[model samples]
Target: MNQNKSGPGTSLVGWNIKSWLSASVNTLDDADLELVYCGSDVPSSQCLSLVKESIPAWQSRAVNFDEGDFFVLSGQQKPVVIMRAKSPTEAQKRDAGLLAPSAYGQARDLVGRAVSEVRKFKSQKVNLRFESCQDREILGALVGLELAAYSYKQSVAAQPAPFPALGLSVKAELKDEAQAIAMGTNIARHLVNSPPNLLYPQSFANAVVELFANVPGLSIDVWDEARLQKENMGLILGVGGGSENRPCMVHLRYRPEGKSEAPLALVGKGITFDCGGLDIKDPAGMRLMKKDMGGAAAAVGTLYWMTQSQFARPLDVYIPLAENAISGKSYRPGDILRAKNGMTVEIHNTDAEGRLVLADAMAVAGSQSGSDKPAAIMVVATLTGAIKIGLGSDVAGFFSTDEALGQVISKRSQEWGDLMWRMPLFDGYRSRLDTNVADINHCATGSYGGAITAALFLTEFAKGYPFSHMDIYAWTDGERGALREAGGSGQAVQCLAGVLQSFGL
Candidate 1:
């Protein structure tokens, strides 16, 4: 075993992290600042000797243990944490206060508690000691700690508080996949956390270029408003005309090594801010509009993950970047916009601008698919409040034109811990977008099945290609579980990444 060195640890923003297994413990000094997890009976272990000797008084309180309950033990310089580790069966029982349905929930919750204790004591470094845990479990805990430690501040001044350095007692092993996924998620969160003023269309495109600079097997192409106009993408131009920032489409391609099959195309909505254009939105409804580009964030994050993890596949992502704000130049309710595919759309509601931008983007992506490539198209967006009303805030509603693709997405979502529910495309609902003046209306007139109708509107641009659409809430309303907070959840990046990874296999 290699002797652990005390140095500047790798952190998400400010929190340092370390991982180890029980067998790697070489000294009692390592347990000087530690978190001990044991079952209700307190499993007997040699590592716990120091913890037991140091705090016999608090150890007695474990006579009647509750899940997630912990007791703090004082050390010479710092406090030691002793937490009750819930069994897998106990964690699965929802009534036991383990709200996260997965078995890994207990381990993740432990990290959350550790972060709190570290903050309370203002400790600069802490260690997590675990027994009989898998590598993924420990990785999940560390990922949780990194995420909980993240806080976005707009100040240029020095940071107010210190973030703790974490040490984990798990076998040093391959952590590339876990860390890459976490990094991707953090990328999405940082993008979503940025205020709209800093993340407008052109700037957002620049950010993607900067992020992918060091990454290999990637190519980026961005089209400004003029270029979009030249391509006759009137839908995108119409929606973004109100904002001075201009509208753009960014194409990121992941070129595979050697001979590979057709690419899987991903389309994400990049509305930097949705002021609801001429239709306008309520103040309360517009407060969180900074996350309007969450779908784009997710797509970017997934690409980050695949590239960082070196997943072998040819992939293409199309992101339509814009800000749906109100101004004299904004498209109004009665305007007809033409898509890149030469199809005309009547704008009944300017608030339904997401689908409009996506329409042109889908056309751009779908047009690239042919007999030689046979690419599959998938669209991700925060398209409607109706999805939130139907599936609530935590779950995303997805619709797919192809059944096999839908099943693969659903399976991957569940496996990756991303919650998704499949919604019906309902070809019968296509008429909801009918308009006398144009080929289609931007939105359905009636209130019912708005999510369905919005998805149905995209199929016209897809042009009978195999496509899947995910309408994600993209922000957590309350605490859900590990790596999830009230801010940007980076919703379906994991699910999308997983599907592409598995499909390639």
Candidate 2:
């Protein structure tokens, strides 16, 4: 965040924040954080609300704890705060150890909430800082939580709210803890929340390219129908056939300073607006389709951090933007469309267009003849009703052929606060998407595992790429938890971003 009279990071220490308070206690000594509590003396539930509500005032000043200083607050005998310094100027480590991981996490929630509250006030400055160790999972998550919170508030039209030019600086080594990830999340959320009128395919592509203009080692490329057709990206072409806006396949790449450790490719489904094509949805259903490109936004957010940060991995992002609107030229259900992979897909559901765009992008991930590719490639898309039905809006659904990759991703997700559930990749479900006339059908014959079926369909074209896909809801509401605000939270950015950093490729 911005520097201020508020004292963001601890000046008492060398500013190396290896740890910080996690909960609210009635007395200063009872807790390491002024606004949060730690033990049974105070319920963590109350602390949660305290965090969300108390964010405003604290932005003007962080909890001031001194190096090696010993102090206690009344009402509870707790070390309300501590400052990590160059020397053994502090001893709250013993006190801090008293609390379990659950309490520590509660503290993270409070800290993140405190940081997020300053979002709307673009004029005044907010200076809140949270301390964390390098390996602490929630450390990065708290940082991301604040960004997600601030970004959510920024999306509101009325957000012209007077808090400050809110800035959050997390003192941690994790990927999401960095400012780049926070800034990128805000930008991606803006892209997702922007109206279709403003964010057409070309404009969106330009926006993604523009996002990398100042960032070192980050680059972008936009391809038109001709480039797609030349490369045999029929799936993207078929879906874009109906839109007047024209389609674009956007590519973004990020290479680290040294030799790449583990190269990773990212693919995002960017259907800027889905009118359902010749097979159209009702006006109500189409209203929120402007966010059909949420996957692209996530990809952009993830790769944005991947490029700008010191992640040792070579990260590349591919986004295929399509606007599925009806025209005489629109591809219809029952019309078999050819994919870049040379597989035929029966148009069981024209509205199932995200997969089509992703199919083309996945097909492009390989060499001209499907030779060399990244060590791993993953796709993100808000592509199905089944995922929504299964995971609900509170969580995301994902399926990966490689269980090991899924575990790593899951670990990062916990750190980033994105809830993801792994569904089955059982081959038995593949039959539901089987079609007689084409190589595969877009939707399953039944709704048994719709999300799994959609994932399977996308996998059909990801032949050479080691790809995993996440079905993100992208929309938010209902909970008032710390740092968790209502609106389009960049659902999976933090998870993959942290994983990207860890993999160093």
Candidate 3:
């Protein structure tokens, strides 16, 4: 493992990764370990023959194996791990593309489990050979294998010895695409896992600059507090006033060669640390506030993948970075702030600060006129606890102004294994944000439908373009599937990347 110091206090470690799909038997011959999948009926003849030759006692073990069970045959030149996978019914196969915990998802998890098991035995190189599998399943398996090797730890003392270099070989052709998506996901995880002291607004901006410094056709711009004040972005400045580190916005533009259509705009809420300001959160609630910037991490990861894969589409990303801390200079609940789009917002609660910074960034995104206007706008944020209550932490909730666009995004999300549910924008909730003193109240009076009201508040600043807002719980609460531990889940990176790739189609 080689650590690359990309920013002031951030280290982006590069994994020694090599993954590809091969059909030839010669490929498996070189691997120290091999994984074979067995359906419910019985192990395949090749698998049985290998088992009998290598370890005859395993024949009875295979017959008694239950679904998701596995047995490792060791003490040979090459070790073999046999996994028992129940064959999916016809109904399961038909509905796999439309539901969570689908066959593809199960395959990914199974592969991830097998890969993790091999790593425990100190096997650095492995091969996975399936008698029969879909391309999507193969892709999932590759992604799972790559992601299973991800671990983030930054210590000043003697660091734990790095995991041995992993070389994964599968039997599919989607290695490049799967590797790109996994890399993007790891990028998000790395950012979200960084300590708050090392990842404030200024350092966050520096990380973005360093990540894309040498990439061609991408321009980066950072707006300081002075520039933000000059532009009258009071909402951003107000929320950031409590912190000495200050608030800033980073705008990234990627333009490919030749004439391109209007670019798509992505706005991310980059609250590096949210102590809930003067309206502070309790100790238990504030323990994981370091992941408050997961939305920005997803956006950064998506852009990084697009540039690396050379996805030829014009795109612009807007990130409003801030820290909602407590101080004498903190913006109060009664303060009314003016957004760049000339709308006044009465602060009802200082804790609801994510939407305030996003309001200004979206205003800037929608400010362009004529040919410069974005074709569509998408905003990503870990915006509300209400969404988690409604959809649970495993599924993200999104609201879109355009029904057709929403449908397309939903389909793309399902295909990529990043689960998202389309929540109603519900114009009926619009009245909740109305206030007597200012143009609108920053937050609703009550907690009812907090997610919907928040989306409605943001819609006011979307400027009538085709808009969608994704409310994500970006932190994984525990170990599950491809995620082997609790940390950043890289929630929307895969889904958003799928949406962008669909644009070119």
Candidate that would win on lDDT = 3
Compared with the true structure, all predictions reach lDDT values of 0.73, 0.61, 0.78
Q: Candidate 3's C-alpha lDDT?
A: 0.78
lDDT tens digits by residue: candidate 3, 205-276: 988887778666788999999999998999999999999989999999878667478999999889999999
Number of the predicted model whose TM-score against the real structure is largest: 3
**For each candidate, what TM-score against the reference?**
0.84, 0.74, 0.88
| Tens-digit lDDT track of model 1 for 152-181 | 552112544444455554434424555556
Model 1 spans with C-alpha error above 4 angstroms: 1-32, 37-54, 63-100, 104-106, 154-162, 169-173, 369-374, 478-480, 483-485
Q: Which has the better TM-score: candidate 1, or candidate 2? A: 1
Model 2 spans > 4 angstroms off? 1-108, 115-176, 368-372, 478-485
Ranking by lDDT: 3, 1, 2
Candidate 1, residue 172: Cα displacement in angstroms equals 5.4
Assess candidate 2 and give its TM-score to the true structure: 0.74
